[model samples]
Target: MSEELDIPEEGTESLYERRAFVIDKGQEPLRIDKYIQMHLEGSTRNKVQNGIDAGFVTVNGKTVKSNYKVKPGDEIILLSLVNPEHTVLKRENIPLDIVYEDDTVMVINKPANMVVHPGVGNFSGTLLNGVAYYLEKQNPGLDEDSLPRFGLVHRIDKNTTGLIVLAKTADAAAHLAKQFFHHDVKRKYTALVWGDMEQDEGTVTGHIARHRQYRKMFDVYPDGETGKHAITHYRTLERFHYVSLVECVLETGRTHQIRVHMKHIGHTLFNDWEYGGDRILKGTIYTKYKQFVDNCFELCPRCALHAQTLGFIHPVTKKEMLFESPLPADMAMVIVKWRNYIANRKEL
Candidate 1:
């Protein structure tokens, strides 16, 4: 089954433009509203039904109601009648670390302290703005408004430095989006947690959602009570008594998945401010140790996490591709300090 949507240009009063799709021959008869909602990402049942009520949905060139039963070979067209909130997108000449670029996709190594996209309080100085500028410069005829500003197939946190994949064309965006949705993309992260795990390797599974009181943070719902399903598999690479370096492989990508999952299991990522890792979780209460930990925090001010590797199939050429990045200087330096501390302890 295939579905198509014509996305309206930025600053346009027409909320959504014309979009059409042909139902699969093997598809079962179902309500048109339900089918559309299921096919589109970030869509709700109420939104789809409202579109139908506004006479924006048609079947076989006839306007249909929300309850219209869709059969095999049905040609469905939807004229979006809702207003999309305008996002403040600006073009800034920010420097970008382009790892690879082709007609289909571009892989970028995003630095820490950089926001992936502009939203809410952040209206400028983002990776998206920089990328948009780069694309516009590459081709003068490119529509700055129609360009894939939100074409990021995946994103890292503002404070977490890592590799992020972006799609240049709509076809590449859809292909990469499906790969991420199906958990076919390989993602591995390196993190320094506050405690050493008893097991060398383990997996954490829970439902994750925004925290109840702290809207900025996330929490694990173990009983599947709320939020989306999340899983993180981790292996201890090295132990520094109070802190441990671990490699985390994501089975499901949820917001703050590695950070929350590690905190759920009593080993929060080192220097993570939100989940209580900023303060020392292990080690003695001596002034010397306190100063040492504080110095380490100064070395890596943000959460001690890095996206070390990413792998996916090429959207255009249909070839296997993989990329790896070494730990940023801050993370690598902190790890070296920990190794020296362990060495000195052994000598003592």
Candidate 2:
């Protein structure tokens, strides 16, 4: 898997499985689900329903309703096949903001909202997809079936954009992954949370797990199941009456580690849609700040989260490197105005 494979050219979603062939010509008249079951192994009716909801299964180059019948020559694109575990990622001439690269590794300034790889609601336009193309363009001798060449070393949340690294060679990938597994890499972030923390610096230690009632969340409780241990260290960069700009360093990585931990500590990032942080500001606690946040809401419509810094030792060279990004302007006012609000309140 570390070896690169030639990815397919970047294009819009296709109707039929791009490279998958029909099980039999006689099955043409069968229902789409049945056709999928017959052609694609381990695919079932329930799996098809799940795929449809996830927007993975499509027909004739377009996503269609589940019950839609198929006709002769109608291409049946199985979204599942595009999965990195299934198909080789292909090149599509996608643009990238390459920060740094060498014989063994590549570093990128990943944009916000672009998932590192395909998952959940995002099946395309992922960093993996882009990297696949980049690798293909770099090495023409590489075969397409072995594509998706860039060896993914680590992953960052889709919304928390920042510096991310990938291994270009299998040896580099395995060595880099070992560093992560052993907690050898250093990672950092800058975020605008909803409230000023009590202390200027702190660390959160907790066991995290998915909520029983909610399908898409994590919780830390006294009686919670034994979830994975995660640690985050934070320090205040700026404080406002209702928010704080904090720098966080990860000692461990887990799903929604920062978002969940901050929310657990009662300071979720503003505009976070999933971890209960999305809302329009209305109070006059700081009108200027409210206006700023409201305007940003209109502009970006994402939580004030950013993986502003990244550092790790080169797997091949053993040299150290680091990268950083400034806090996006959308969440800047959360700190600027809140500082004024707190100062004015002190004046009273």
Candidate 3:
């Protein structure tokens, strides 16, 4: 089911307003108090717990305890604002899943379908928003131009899941940005695409730019607008009758770099229906799983891209650092179903 909600612009009296949400799978066991504390746009632990206590946070049309666990497909009504005060990013007693942190750098395993930073159509519910809050709350006057953003370095796409780095100081941010610019940050991705392998391994090297007609899309070109150079190395970890499991390595991180380059080749990722994806599954070789893929592409909305690994040098200590995230449930299930299809067809 699709939902289009326009938040009311009222409630200027209180900084935080109200919101509604319907939980998807894998979010079960999430405590009401803790979920609101972490996921609310700019809400703090005290505010969220208070909301829970005040009967504002209703679950399935009833007031529940703060310890109430959110089951899959549960309906949660969050009485909160889109973006609250304490500046762009404020620390609000939220817990971070930090993999590694030092004086200069931090590595985090970002969950899938999460935006790294705030941009258009996303002022909250972002890693950046949370990071900004964390920095402002931790260090007074930390947002000075000399040391902006608690040292956020490189970024990953909203739907593209993976590892990312953060800078606690300005020196670290600048240094890490330089490392990414020089293509020194080691990045890898795991994706299940919809195609048989022409070769067991390959590379797609090109420049990428925003699509001419499709404003939200990116495309590759032989000679396009001063686009940065990018290279992608991929190998079939496992091959099925129709699709292949590919491991992608990035040589340059550009906007939608890997997604665009991968599609530039004949292999569009299994769940990617954006770059010339017809709602009706296309491609002659896809006959095996076309119907199933069509149904999946319609029901499962997220793309199949995932940032499986990230590695870089510590901007301050000059030491190496790494982080990784596992595949999200929906994507994993898609692969599972497709694998079953391949095995049955193989037996036939």
Report RMSD (Å) for each prediction in the order shown: 8.5, 13.2, 18.4
Residue lDDT tens for model 2, 141-192? 6654332323665677778767878877645654565566557778888888
TM-score of each: 0.78, 0.69, 0.66
Residue 158, model 3: Cα distance from true site in angstroms: 1.0
User: CA lDDT of 300 in candidate 1?
Assistant: 95
Q: Write the per-residue lDDT of candidate 1 for residues 106-129, one digit (tens) a residue.
A: 999989999877666666888888
Q: By summed lDDT, which 10 consecutive residues of candidate 2 come out lowest? A: 8-17
Worst 10-residue lDDT window for candidate 1 reads 7-16
Q: Which portions of model 3 miss their true places by more than 4 Å?
A: 1-95, 144-150, 223-226, 277-291, 298-300, 346-348
Q: Candidate 1 — which residues are off by over 4 angstroms?
A: 1-88, 148-150, 346-348
CA lDDT of each prediction against the hidden true structure:
0.79, 0.66, 0.64
Q: Which candidate number maximizes lDDT?
A: 1
Q: Which stretches of candidate 2 lie over 4 Å from their true place?
A: 1-86, 144-150, 280-292, 332-348
- Clashing residue pairs in candidate 3 are 17-80, 18-80, 89-132, 89-133, 90-133, 91-133, 150-167, 151-167, 161-307, 193-270
- Global lDDT for candidate 2? 0.66
- Model 2, clash count? 17
lDDT of 2 at 311: 84
